[model samples]
Target: MANVNTAPSWHAPHAGFIRVLVGLFTVAALVVIAMTLAYPGPDPHTIVLVSAGISLVALNIVAFTLPWGRLPRRHTFWLALAQLVITILLAGTLYQTNNAIPLLALIPVLWIAFQLDWPHTIAIIVALGLGCIAFWLIVEPMPSRPRVIVAISVFYFVVASLAILTQANADALRRSRAIAEEAWRSQQDALASAESNAAVMRAIAHGVDAAVFFASQDRSSTFANQRAQELGRRMGVSAQDPTWAGHEVYGPDRVTPIPPEDQLLPRALQGEYATESLQWVGEPGAQHAVSVSSLPAVTEAGEQVGAVIVAHDITNLVEALHAAESFSATVAHELRTPLTSIVGYLDLLETDDLDETGREFLRRAQQGVTSLSAKLRELLEPFEVAGASPTFSFIDVVDLLRRRVNHWRESAGTRGIVIEGPDGSSRLQVPLDRELAERMVDAVLSNAVKFSASGGRIEVAVDTHENSARITVTDHGLGMTREETRHAFERFYRAPTAIRRALPGFGLGLATALSIAQAHGGTIRLESAAGAGTTAIVEISLTQVGVAARGSS
Candidate 1:
C-alpha cells in the first residue's frame, strides 16, 4: 500500500550556486549601464532600460539575504523560477538594441537545471527555447536569426542536462553515507552487549561462595570456578582435568567408593536431578560435610544441552548438631541423678509414721519428682534412638491404648477430667515398637490432661482402615488459634494461650509425637480453633505389619 522507492522532497540547489547567480546578475547589470552611457541612447528609453536592469540586480541581492538553504523545496523552486523570468525579460530588452545580451539567458537556464529535477528542468528549458525564437523574430530584426536561435537552445539544453546528472550523484552519495552510519551504530550496540554479558559471568565465577561446575553435552569439556577447584582438591580429584566424568567419588564412610552412575554429575548428564550430602575425611582426620546438587541445563528451545553442578560445605552445621545431641544427653543424665534421689527420699518418708497433712505433702513431692523424671526421659528419646532401627512386634491395638489411657486416668481424675475410649474391644493387631508406640500415646494424652479444664472430657478413639490404623484424641479445653495449630508440632513452640496460662511444658510433646509417627511411615493431623476444642489424628500404615506376619509364618 505504500511506495517503497519514494524520493526525499527536500533536495534543492546548494547555497553556493545561489551566491554565484547573485554575483553574475550584479556584473551583468553594471555592463548594461556602462554600454548605455557610452552609446548615448535616447534619454527616456535609456533611463527606462537602465532602471529595469538595476532593479533585477537589486532583487538578486535581496534573494541572497534570504535563508535559501533552509527553505522548503516547493518555495525554493518558485524563487528560482521568479529569478529566471526576470533574467529573460532583461535579456529580451537588451537584445532589441542589437547587443550580445542573449547570452545572459544562460544564467536563468543554469539556475533552473541546478535547482529542479529532470521533469521541471526540461519543461523550463523548452519554454526558454521558445522565448529565444520569439525574441529573434519579433523583438530583434537581426540577420542570421535562425542560427542565433539554434545556438542559444543547444547551449541551454547541454548545461541543464549536466546539472541534472550532478544533482542526482550528490543525492546518491548522501544516502549511502546515512546507511553506512546506521550499520556502524548497530555493530557497536552488539559489541557492547557481548562485553556486558562476559563481565557478569566473570563476576559470578569469582563472587559466589558455592562451588560451581559446568560440563559440555558430551562431557568432553568442563569448567570449574575457584570454589569448585578447592572442593575437588580436598576430595583428591584432579580439578584441572578436562574429562572427569567417570572419576571415583567417596561416600560418607570415606572408605567405599560410590558408583560413577550414582554421582551427581553423571546422574545430571543422564537428565536426572540429584541433591545429597556426603561426609569426607581429610588428611588431618577432619570431617567435612559437602552438599552437592546437579541439574540438567536447558536452552531457550527446551533442549538439554549440558549440566550444572553446585557444591556447598556444611561442616559447621553438622558439627553443631552433633554437639547439641551430646549436650542434651549430658544434661538428661545430670538431672536424672538428683531426681532419683528425691524420689527415693520421698519413698522413705512415706514408710515412716507421720501426720496426715505431712503424708499428703510427701505424696505430692513424690508425684512431682516422678513426673519430672518421665519428661526428662521423653525429651532424650530422639537422641537416644538415633541410628537405631525399630524392633517390630505384633501388639494388640486396643489393649495398648487401654493400658496407656488407664495410666493417665488417675491424673485426669484429680482435676475431674474424664477420658473416654472406644466402646468395644477387638483384637486389632499392629506391628510396631511397643515402647515407642506407648511413648507416642503418652505424649498425646499428657497434652489433653494438661490443657483440659476441670470437669472437661477427653475422648480417645481407634479404628482400622484398609491398610492402616487411625488414632484420634479430642479434648474440650482452652483451644488454639488456627495459626497456633499450624505450628503446634514445631520444636520449642508454645501457643500464646498456653504461655499466658503458665502451663507446665517444654513444648516437645507434639514434636516428639510427630517424629515417632513419621518413623513408622505415618502422619499426624491437628484441627483446632480458638475457644473451640482441639483434635489430633495420627494415621500409621499396616503394610509393614502384614509383611512382618508373613515373615514370621
Candidate 2:
C-alpha cells in the first residue's frame, strides 16, 4: 500500500523551488541593505528599487510555500492556502507602490490559473484586479498615471485571457493523452487475459482424460485442441462441429448423447455461459460423473461475445464422499443402541435397593455409561454442526458459568479439587448462544477441575472491556508439554501425561470449546507450562447489542 512517506526521495524536483526562494530572499535582502547604506536618504527611485526587490523575494517565498512540484496532496492544499494570502498581499503592495511593477502581479495570477482548476483561478484573478484598481484610486500616482493605469489594466486583462486559453488547451491535451493511454492499457490487459485463459484451458484439457473447447461470437470455434477432437470421435460426436452440439458421442463403452441439460454449445451460440457436473447414461447401467464449467466471454465494453466450457470426469471423488458419509452414519447408529441399553441398566441399578458394595458397583457402572455417552456425542457432534443454524442472542454469561461450575463442582470435589470464580464485583454479560456457550465453558472448566491435583485451584475470571470480553480459566496442576499443548485442541488427541495419570476424558473438550467460541465470533487460547499451571482464555467481541446486553446482564 502506498502511504504518505515521512521522508521522500531527496532528489525530488519541488525542493528546487524552495531553494530558489531562499536564495532569492537572501540575495535581495543583502542588496537592499547595501543600497540603503549607499544612498542614506529617501530617494523615490532607490526606494522603488528596494521595494521591487523585496516584492520579488516575497513572490518567490509564496511560490515556495505552494504545492508547486511533488509535495503530498494534503500538505499541498494547506500550504497552498497560506501561499494564496501572501500572494494577494504582495500583489496589492506592488500595484499601489509602483504602477510599472503592477505587471508582476500577473505572474501569480497565471501561476494560480495553471496549477488549480477554473473556479479558484477566476476568483484569484477577480480579487487581485479589483484590489489593484481600488489601491490605485487611493494612492496619488506620478505624472503618467492614466497611461500607466491603462497599460497595467490591459496587461492584466490580456494575460488573464491568455492564461484561461492556455489552461483549457493543456487540460484538453492531458485528457486526450489519458484516454489514449487507458485504451492502450485495456488492449494489453485484454490480450494478457486471453492468453492466460487459453493456457488455463489447455492445461485443464491436458490434465483430464477429457476434451474442452471455447467458441467465439461469429459462431466459429475459437479454441479446440487435438484431445477435444479425439474425445469427440470416441464420444460419437462429429469433429466437424468443433463446438459440440447435442449430437450422439460414442465412447469406448457405448453410444451417448450429450445430456439435454449440458447443451453448452447451443447456449454459447446464444452468448450465454452454461455449466454442468452431470453423469451421462450410456449402456443399461453405465454412467460417469463429469465436472463441467462454463463462462461467458465479454469484451472491455461489457459486450457478451461468446462462452467457454471445460468438462472433467470426477466420478471417483463423488463416489468416495458418498461412501464416507454412509459409513459414518451407519457406525454412529450402530453404537447408539448398545449405549442406550447400558445407560438405562445403570440408571435402574443405581436407583434400586442396594448395599454399600452394590451402590459402589452401580456408581462405577454409571460412570462408564457417562463416558460412553460423551464419546458417542463427540462422534455425532460434527454431523450436527453441518446442519446447525447460526443463531445468536443475549445470554447471562456469569449466571450460566455459575450453574455449570456448580454442576461440575460436586464431581471435582470428589477428587479433592477446588474451583474459583469471579467475585460479585465483576461484570459477566456477553452476547452468545445459551446452550452452545454454556456447553463450551462447561467443557473447558470441567477439564481444568479434572486435571488439577487434589486440593489444587481452578480459577475462572470474566473480564469485560469497551470492545470485548474475556473469560479465563486457570488450573494449577499437571500441565502439558509444548507438543501436547500444540495439538491439545485436536479431537481425540489425549496427551500421554493425561492418559497415563488415569484421567478419564475423550479429549474432545478443547475441540468442542473451540468450535463454539468460533461460532460466536470468539476464540479460545491457552497458556501453560509442564508443572506451572494452565490458563485458558476465551475472548469474544462486544460489538453487537445482543452481546453487550447479555454480557451486562
Candidate 3:
C-alpha cells in the first residue's frame, strides 16, 4: 500500500518586520564601529567598543537568518531574552566609555514587543528601565548630556508600545481569516448535498412509468419529466395544470364529472392524500390512475407547503383485462354445447351396455366427460371472480395421485411408454379437495405421457412429512430449453420444440395444475434442460386453513 500523508504542512513565519530590524541594526552597528575606530579616546577603549559593535552586527545577522517568529512560544521568548541581554550588555559597556549608545537598547525592546506576550514584554520593559537607572547612577553622564539619556529612553518606550499594538491587530486578523475559511467549507458541503439530492430525484423521475410533477406553494409547476410532458400533450394541455382545455374529468363510470373538492391535486393542496382512477374526455379519450401525496416543505419546524402529483397510465392493463374476460365468456359458450352433448350420449350408453368390459368402458368414458366439463367450469370461473377460493376436503392425496396415474397408464402403454408409481401403501392423508387433487395429478401425468417418446419411462413418487406432502414426476422425454422451462406454466405457452413436433396440447394443463397447487397453499417447481429430460415437484402444505369442507365420498 502507498503511504498517505496526513500531517499539515508547516507554515513559515512573516519575516518582513524582522528583516527591516536586522537591516537597520546592521547599518547602525557598522557606522558606530567605523566612528569608534577613526577617533580613539584618551582611555583608548577602541578595541572594546569595536568588539561590542561587531557582536551586535553578528547577533542581528543570526536573527535575520533564523525564523525566530515561527519557533515555539517559549523558545521565541528565550531567544528574545538573549538578544535583550546582549544588547543591554553592549550598551552598558558603551556607556561606561561615555560613547552615548543608549539607542541600541530600543532594538531589544522592539524584538520583545513583537515576539513575546504582554506579561513578558512588560517584565522585560521593567528590567530595561532598571538597567537604565543603574547606567544613570554608575556611569553618571555629564550635566550637559543628561537630556540625551532621557530622550533615548523615552523613544525606546514609545516604539515598544507601538509594536504591542501591531501584534494585537495581527492576532485579530488571523482569527477572522480562520472563521471565513470554515464558512466557505460549510457552503461547499451544502452545495454538494443539494446536487446529490437533485441527481437522485432526476433518476427517479426518468426511470419510472409514472408521470411526476414538482410544484411550488403557489401551485405553479417547477419541473416535469419526459413522461409527464408527453402526458400533458396527449391531454391537450400543459402538465402543470390539473385540468386543461375545459375538458371534463370523470370517475370510473366516465359519465359524471368528479367533484372539484375530491379532485386529486386540489385535495393534496389541502393537506390530504388522494388517489383515483379518472377518464379524460376529449376527441380521443384517455385514462389515468392518479395519486397525489403532499409533504410540507418546511424548515426544522413543521409547516405546510405545496404537493407532488404522480399520474400513472393504466389504460393498456385495463383493456387487456376486459379482453381476457370476453375471451373466457366466448370459450365457455362455444365448448358448453358440445361437451354437454358428449356427456349426455355417454350417460345413455352406460344404460344400454351389454358385456362387463363394454360396461366398464362406458363408465370410464362418462367419467372422462364429467371431468372435462368440471375443468371448463373451473377455468371460466376465474374471469368472473379473480380470487375465488377453492372448495376443500379431507382425502388421501397420495391415493388420488395413484388413481390418476393408473388412469393415464393404459393410454401411455399404447405408445410403449411405462408409468411407474411409488411402491407399497401410496396413501398420505391431507386436507384437500379430492377432485381438484385428482385434476392436478392428471394434468401433470398427461403432460409426461404426451412428451415422452416410445419406450420412455415416467417415474412418479409421493413422500409424506409432518407438515406437508410432496409429489414428484420425472420423465425421460424430449426436454425443454431454459427459456421454455421458465415460461412453461404460463397460460397458453408451449415450448418451441413441442410446437415444432406438433404435440397435441392446448398448453393449459401445467398452468391449471400450477394454479390448483397454489390455491391449496402449495407450489410446483419444474426443472429441465434441453435433451436431458424433466423433473416436476409439487408440494402442498397440510396445515392450510379452509380445509374443513365435506369429506371426499
lDDT of each: 0.73, 0.65, 0.69
TM-score of each: 0.53, 0.39, 0.46
Tell me the lDDT of model 3 at 190: 67
Regions more than 4 Å wrong, model 1? 1-198, 201-205, 220-223, 239-258, 275-278, 281-284, 295-306, 387-389, 396-428, 441-545, 548-553
Which regions of candidate 3 are displaced past 4 Å? 1-322, 338-389, 478-486, 495-507, 545-553
Q: On residues 16-78, what C-alpha lDDT tens digit does candidate 1 reach at each position?
A: 667787778778777777777777665465775677677777877887788867865445555
lDDT string, candidate 3, 418-444, tens digits: 999876565666777666677688888
Error of 3 at 185 (Å): 15
Assess candidate 3 and give its lDDT: 0.69
Q: Which scores better on lDDT, 1 or 3? A: 1
- TM-score of predicted model 2? 0.39
